[model samples]
Target: MKAAVVQEDKTVKVAEKAVPKLQPNEILLKTVSVGLNPTDWKHVKNFSRPGDIVGCDFVGKVVEIGSEVPVGEIKEGEVRWGFTRGGVDGERGGFAEYVAVDWDLSSVVPSNVTPQEASSIPIPFLTSVQALYIHLGVPEPPEKVSGEPWILIWSGFTAVGRYAIQLAKLSGFKVATTASEKNWAKLKEYGADVVFDYKDPDVVKKLKEATGDKIEYGFDCISEKGSVQLSQQAFRPEGGRLILLLPTPSESELPRPDVKTSTTLAYMMLGTPIQWGKITLPAQPEDRACFVRWTKITTELFAKGAIKPLDVHVVGDLDKIQEALDMLQSGKHSTKLVLNVS
Candidate 1:
């Protein structure tokens, strides 16, 4: 298989590598599409090393399942979408033509969604799902808005932020969001009742004006610039909950407030308690169960078209992986970038 290896910082090379085999609880998948994320290049450049093949979000057909796998419920030929941990096992990752998927992290891709679309969902959707529905006690996806809470997603144009908006809408939140100017209208279509431009000098004022100063729930999709700071302001004293997709501050970075804050390592959160327990710090059963229920809910929303995948910037071929990465880093791509691996 021809895979892109990060030979060093800002350097990548297409090289042939042996295909990976599945472990007892894993599934072997022939990659059809790979979603490029901000982290892919960040890790590659930061490490300045050759080892990590860091692409995560993926969608493909399961070619083989382990003997211990109970895939009969999912079926062998089903299309699926999911996140993979960085550096799966000992090898690099989904940048290649194949990946050994841990069964627990995988989910069936709706037949109606293309591989490119499916690939875009796993990481971003799971990020929003884990953060809002599980961690913050937001309602489950694909459910009617029966008593749903209000949520303010701080970056509605981001892939994760886009998913957060759609999920909140589908699960029954009166959603509000902040985005770049051009995306404000699109965010409205995605179900944000109010959309504010983060670039506006009065962005925080606009948010407060829209919510009437009773801010309670927030999802901070951008870690830097004005987004994080404004989010802190929007959070209500003790009722506030903020979930960050980026690295959250230690006690030092946290504001002295009664608000609750959490960060998610989304792929790892899909595990069963046993799987999580193996890592030494397991998810509480309650947390694990909420994730499971939300997973099913999000999957159903995708299947029913209640929550749509973000419009993707489809980079034409695997050979253009570098260009795609460059585009993402340059902040030129407005939507998720999907590599046509097939």
Candidate 2:
């Protein structure tokens, strides 16, 4: 098997590696396509070792199933898509000819979605699910939310922000988001009720005025670059909860003491502790349970055309992995970049 492996100098190189042995609760997948994300590059620069595999989001066909997997839950030849913590192990990441994934963390691709499109869903979509329903307390879809509450999503054009906007609207909440002027229309199309230019000096004020200080919940897709401060300020004076995709800033760094903050780690959906640098996030079975439940719900949503996959730009195969990573790191692509691996 050939995989994109990290180098000691923080670069990705395609190298030959042995196929992973399947675990009792896992499934062996023949790779179809993989998606590129900012985390992939970050892992290379920050956490990965010389031999770590370097990709996360993937769609693959089940070549083999584990003995412990429930009968009929997943079958050989079924197309499944999910994400793993990339840049950690030599055989575990997505940019490979073969992958072994936990059966519980993977989901069947909807009949209508292509493999490239399905590869773009797992990380961003599930991150939005955790941020809105699990931490922010927004009601999940198919449940009635009493009022037209407003929730702010910072960096609305990002993959996670786009999904958050759509999910919030589906739950009957009015959505407000920050993005550049160029993406305002697309954000609105994704179900954002109001879009503010994040570069504007009065962005927070405009959001407060537009929502009448009723913005109680927020999700910060880009936690750095003053985004957290702006998102916190947009909340009402009484304050509310804010969910972040990165580490939450310390109390003194945050502008408001009233706003409660928590970070969403999508890797936790694997039901395993994540070790990055000196921090070790323990496994939360409850988070995994929520993820498993929503995976089914999201599949139904896709079938009903209620949720749409992000637009994707195919960037060729495994050899193009470094080029795709460079594009993502350049912050130049608005559409998801996918690599055809099969």
Candidate 3:
């Protein structure tokens, strides 16, 4: 098997390695397409294990399933895509010809979603769901939303932000969002009722005014400087909850006191809390349960066209993984980037 591994000095090189051995409930996947996220580059920069595989989020064909797999739900040669972390320490990721993941973590890709498109679904989409339903306590998604409970997703054009907007809408909240000028209509098409330009100086005020400051939920997909600060202000004066993809920045960039805040780190999906900086957080019992519920719901949504994948820009084969990561790191591609792992 061939996989991309981080070298001692933190560079990725395609290297030959043996295929992973599967456990009783694990499925062996032959990689088809792997998605790139900003975290991929971050892991590369903080290379820990010299030769560990270096990617996450993939769509692949099942070469084999463990004996314990549910009888009719999945089978050999089936195509699947789901959430699993890769490319750090000794944990194998999806950047290789073959990888193994527990069966509970994946679902068969529906016909409507190509391997490439499905590849981009896991991390960002799951991140949004975790941020909303788990971190922020938004209700479960209903088939038909009755009321116009509004929530604001700052940076809504982002991969995670788009998912947040759609999920918020499905979960029965009226959605408002801020994005660059070019992404307004795109966000609207995804169910954002109102879209504001985040680049505008008065954006927070404008968004609050548009929603009557009743917006109580926010997801900061782009946690750059000033993003959380601006997003927290859009909530009503009574106070609301905000979710950050990363830690809230320094005291200088802190959001207002009225906004209760939390973070949704997707890695918590691994069933263990991460040792981030000096913080030793406890594991989240909700993440795995949420992933199970969400995988069932979102896969059905994908099959029925209730939700859709972002446009995927396929960047060729396994050897081009580095190029794909570079594109994401440079912040050049507007759509999701997928690498065909032939």
lDDT of each: 0.73, 0.90, 0.83
Give the winner by TM-score: 1 or 3.
3
Clashing pairs in 3: 53-87, 54-87, 86-93
Name the TM-score of candidate 3: 0.95
Q: Which candidate should be chosen as best, given lDDT against the real structure?
A: 2
RMSD of each: 3.5, 1.0, 1.8
Q: Give the distance in Å from residue 322's predicted Cα in candidate 2 to where it truly belongs.
A: 0.8
TM-scores, all candidates, are: 0.88, 0.98, 0.95
Candidate order by decreasing lDDT: 2, 3, 1
**Residue 249 of model 2, lDDT score:** 89
Which parts of model 1 are misplaced by more than 4 Å?
87-90, 141-148, 237-239, 250-256, 270-295
**Looking at candidate 1, what is the lDDT of residue 249?**
72
Off by over 4 Å in 2: none
Global lDDT of model 3 = 0.83
* Per-residue alpha-carbon lDDT of candidate 2 for residues 109-168, written as tens digits (9 for 90 to 100): 889999999988989999999888888776677884778888899999999998888999
Best by TM-score: 2
Q: How well does candidate 1 match the true structure in TM-score terms?
A: 0.88
**lDDT (Cα, tens digit) per residue for candidate 1, span 1-342:** 766677745565566777876788888777888898877777567643575565777777888888888746456777777666543322647777787776766777777777888878877877887787677775453345465556889888888888888778766778878877788788888888998888888877887778776567889988776466678776555457777776667756656355576777565564533232235446456554555565566567778888787788788777887788888899977878888776
The collision pairs in model 2 are: none
